[model samples]
Target: MIILAATPIGNLGDASRRLVEALANAEVIAAEDTRTASSLLRALGVDNRPRMIALHEHNEVERAAELVELAREQDVLVLTDAGMPAISDPGFPLVQAAAAADVTVTAIPGPSAVLTALALSGLPTDRFTFEGFVPRKSRVPALSKLAREERTMVFFESPHRIAESLDDMATAFGGDRPAAVCRELTKLHEEIRRGPLAELAEWATGGVRGEIVVVVGGAAAASLDLPTAIAQVLALVEGGARLKEAATEVADATGLGRRELYEGALKERGR
Candidate 1:
């Protein structure tokens, strides 16, 4: 069996009893960083020293098969530096390999920076999406794709680029889009800055620090007549989106019936 364990994002006290027990008894561990895993064990006062395999983004693809074979013989504990493995971290390939090998895979649920930030974000949590880390470059194009996203969006970002990211978000999502920047979550200097994307962008100009999670509220429904909505759908379709996808996108934003928009676009295209 392969066990995926979640570590504390910031606060040590957030580490669950199950995680501690797993670390204490783990025989072979697949860790994103063996050194960090060792530090966590030492901090948790887990005396048992497990054999740590360095499983990181660079080597995970090559190491996954080897780890899967070993898991057939012994329980392998997977850990990232923080949070759960395979969550925008290493371990996805390992899990895929394990699933293909019919090896039993399970997880010990615990703290997550994404959920923590979202819960504290004060945005509509009923519907949300975790978009992982923002692209270092091409952010405008990347974020433009989500311009009409109707679910609260969550993202991880480095402090150095937070300002640029927020600015780009303002451009893509509008300066007045409500957002929350959760910094150094659950840590000593934990800060949750909430305001419009433009304001946050300005605040970040002076520099921000530590682990950051940005949550932006979803787009409000736009008021548009069917003809206008259909034209937008056709534009997206011309830009390489599938007809159905384009219709759905526009429909979601304009609160139009998807089938009606799709049929109208099809009729307009046939004209």
Candidate 2:
């Protein structure tokens, strides 16, 4: 069986009983950083050290097949430095391989920076998307991809790049679009800063530390005339947002209702 476990994002107490048992019993552990995994195990008071292997970005592709092979014979546990494996981490390829090999796969779900940020964001969470992290290079293209994400969107970023990412979001969406920057979630000194993208960008410029999670509100409803709303939606869409997202941005920007703007955009798209 293949077990994908969630490690604590910051607080070690967040580790679950299942995760602890998995660590104790697993024959092999694939970790992004072996030293971090060892430290976590020690902190949890688990004396046994399982055979640990490195499986970060550089070697994930080659390592995945080997890990999958191990899962076919014995229990293999995959973990990252923090949070769940494969969530913007290094476990997806192994999971994919295990699935192809018909291996039984499961998760010992626990702490998540994504969910933690969303819960603290004070934004709409009923419908949300986790984008992991935006691409470092070609940020414009990356922001464009998320332009149409209608659900509240979550992104992981480093402290240094938070300001730049926020600025790009402001440009991709609108300066006034709502967002929240959650730092050091589930840890002491945790902070949640919420407001428009422009304001957040400015606030981040002063300097930031610790882990960063960004939660952005979806585009606003379009209350303007059909043609005007359509134009606004089209502009955002052309600039790299999804159509549904563009409509939301238009609605928010124009103080129009969501349903109306959605319908208008659909009509314009001949949907």
Candidate 3:
């Protein structure tokens, strides 16, 4: 059997009793960082010494088979530095390997950064998606694809990139899109800043620190009428956005035709 465990994201006190007990009795543990695992055991006051193996993004693929084989004999507890193993962390491949080998896999669910951020975001939580982290190089293109997504979105990001990321998001989804920036959640200096994407992006320019989670509200459900949409295109053009680019933006958000928006705006401009 393979046991996937959830570690506290920030507050150590959030560690569940089941997690503590599992660590106390675990014979073998595959941890994202063995040193961090050791530190966790020490912090939790677990006296039992479990054999630990390193399993992270760099080596999880090759290590999965070995860990899966060990699970056939006894339960192998899986852990990451914080949050659940296999989330944005390094446990999915191992779990997949175990599944392919027909080994039983179970989880000791507890704290999750994704869930914590979403619940605290004040956005519609009934439907949502966890997008792990935004790409470093292809950020805009990647986020632009999600511009029309109706489900609330959650993404993890580093402090250094938060400002640029939020700015790019504003450009993709429009500055008025609702969003929340969660920083250092469950920690001493935790903050939840909720507002329009433009406002948040501007505030982030001052600099941000610590673990970050961004929650963006889904696109509005109804598409605007063509005339209204075209007017929006013209308005954007008036604000210095290229006519074609402005039309494309409105078309994407309002489910209209890019050509129609561009032509309509052009005719209106001529009139």
Prediction RMSDs, each to the true structure: 5.7, 6.4, 4.8
lDDT of 1 at 85: 92
**10 residues in a row with least lDDT, candidate 1:** 223-232
Residue 175 C-alpha lDDT in model 2: 70
TM-score of each: 0.84, 0.82, 0.87
User: Candidate 3, which segments miss by more than 4 Å at Cα?
Assistant: 224-253, 261-271
For model 2, the local distance difference test gives 0.83
Question: For each candidate, what is the lDDT?
Answer: 0.90, 0.83, 0.89
Where does candidate 1 clash, by residue pair?
Answer: none
Query: Taking the tens digit of each residue's C-alpha lDDT, what string does model 3 give over 147-229?
Result: 77899999999999999999978876778889999989989999999999999999999999999999999988877567656
Per-residue alpha-carbon lDDT of model 2 for 130-213, expressed as tens digits? 887866875754564555567999999998888888887776666777999999888899999999999999999999999999
Model 1, 129-201: lDDT tens digits are 9999999876765775687788999999999999999998886677788999999998999999999999999
